[model samples]
Every structure is written in C-alpha cells, then in structure tokens.
Target: MDGATQFAVSALINILTSLICITLSWWVLQNVRLDLFLRNPGGIQGKMLQVLLSIVLGHGLAVFFIDYLGWSGMIGQLF
Candidate 1:
C-alpha cells in the first residue's frame, strides 16, 4: 500500500481501538461504587467524573495496546 493508504489505515485502527476501549472502560466503571467517594454519585458532577475517568483510562489502555502491537511487529526486524 501507498503511504497515504497506510496512514489512513493506521488512523482508522487507532480511532476504533480508542473508542472500543473507552466503551469497555465505561461499562466496567458502572460496577464501581462511586457513592463511597462522592457525596452524590447520581449527580451531574459525578457523571462527568465518570466520563472523564473513562476517557483517561481508555486512552491509556489504547496507547498501551497500540504501542505493544507496534513493538511486537518490529521484532521481525531482529532476525
């Protein structure tokens, strides 16, 4: 594939991975008991906090996976 095509594919993969991870994180976070830490877990602020945490955690996880895949692919160069 050409450079542009490769770039597009990589971009698509990164976006999809980030979105999937974010969704997974959001779903998993629903089980956490935020009431223990928050005065009102059902309030808007609490919900915002959950969303922010989900994005941060999901992005971190996505970066890790993407980096791991890239590094593993590079292993072939060692031969």
Candidate 2:
C-alpha cells in the first residue's frame, strides 16, 4: 500500500481496537457484574476501578490479538 493508504489503515485499526475494547468492557460489567470485587462497589471509586480494569484488560487483549494471534495482519488486509 501507499504511504497514505497505510496511514489510513493504521488509523482505522486503532479506532476499531478502541471501540471493541470499550464495548467488551461495557458488556462484561453489565452482564457479569465483574466490578463487585471492589470495596465501594456502588461508588465513584468502584466506577473508576472498573474503568481502569477495563482499559488494562482491553489493551492487554489487544496486544495479544495483534501480536500472538496476528489478527492485526488480518485486519490490515481488510482495509
């Protein structure tokens, strides 16, 4: 791909990765009540903890998907 095309592909992948991560986090919290482990489960602290957990887990999963599974290459091909 040309430089411009490659840039666009990279941007698109980043956006999609973020969206997927947020969606997965929301789904897990809503359906699984995974934030119950927090001390103040219904307070701001709990909410912040949940957000942090989601971000870390999301990034970790994204790295695994891109590096270990080579899904990044598959996604790049789609663009």
Candidate 3:
C-alpha cells in the first residue's frame, strides 16, 4: 500500500504487458508472409533479430497510440 509497493506492482504489470505484447507481435508476424520468410527456414540466427525487432516495435507502437491518441482524438470527442 506504500509508495514502494505501488511502484513494484506497477513495474510488474508493465513487464507482463510488454511480454504479452511481444509474444502477440511475434505470432502475428510469423503468420504474415510466413512462406516467404521461411523459404530458407531460418534455424536460429535469422529469426532472432526479427523477433527482437518485433517486440521492441510492438510495445513502442502500443505506447505511442495509447498515450497519443486520446489527445489526438479531441476533435472526434467534440462530435
């Protein structure tokens, strides 16, 4: 109930959210043009960078839209 406790809980939630976001992103990308991506069948090296980029970008985009859209939607909110 204290400041530290709240911070800890918030941090945990953020971590879980980011993890879920990354996983969701990877799954989506895997299905998208999967045949082309896996034409050579990346064993380990090829998939690693793609996975990392997907996670970082996925969480980043989510944060951007969530924090920015509410402000950007002011016109729609008026109508």
Candidate 4:
C-alpha cells in the first residue's frame, strides 16, 4: 500500500476507536442508571449518585486501560 492508503487506514482505525470508547462510556452510564432506578424506585438522590458514579468509574477504567496498553512502548525507555 502507498502513503495515501496507509493514511486512510490509520484514520479509519482512529475514528472507530473513538466511537467505541464513546459508546462504551454511554453504556456504562445507561446500564448503571437503569439498575439504580430499579433499586431505588422513589429516590431522586440515588439516581443522581448513580450518574455521578458511572461517569467517574468509566473515566477511571478508560485511563487504566490506556496506560496498560502503553506500558510495552514505555518499558525500554527507562532501561
């Protein structure tokens, strides 16, 4: 493949990755809220807490996974 083909492939991969990350985050919130709603059927505060917790947990997991994937690339630099 030539330069143009390589660039297009890379761009496509990047776009797909971004979309997946966003969708996963949304899923995290949606599913958590659903559970919370069922558990606390009459509590407004509980639902609010559920949304906040989901956002925090989702971001934490995202950072953790990114760092783990980057570990191999970083290993040799400190050697």
The models' CA-based lDDT, in order, is: 0.96, 0.72, 0.70, 0.63
Best model per TM-score:
1
Model 2 worst lDDT window (10 residues): 64-73
lDDT of 1 by residue, 1-79 (tens): 9999999999999999999999999999999999999999999999999999999999999999999989998998899
Write the candidate numbers in order of decreasing lDDT.
1, 2, 3, 4
- Candidate 4: 10-residue stretch with minimal lDDT: 33-42
Error of 2 at 44 (Å): 0.4
lDDT of 2 by residue, 1-79 (tens): 8999988987788768866977697667666564556666779887777788788877776666556436656787897
Angstrom error at residue 79, model 1? 1.8
What is the lDDT, from 0 to 100, of the residue 77 in candidate 1? 89
* Native-to-model Cα distance after best TM-score fit, residue 21 in candidate 3, in Å: 0.2
Tens digits of lDDT, candidate 3, 59-78: 98667654564467676888
**lDDT by residue for model 4 (1-79), tens:** 9999987986775556555565577676655536534676447966666656655666666556666756865887889
Q: Rank the candidates by TM-score, best first.
A: 1, 2, 3, 4
| Alpha-carbon runs more than 4 Å astray in model 2 | 31-36, 68-79
Local error of candidate 4 at residue 57 (angstroms): 9.7
RMSD of each: 0.6, 4.7, 5.2, 6.1
TM-score of each: 0.97, 0.66, 0.62, 0.43
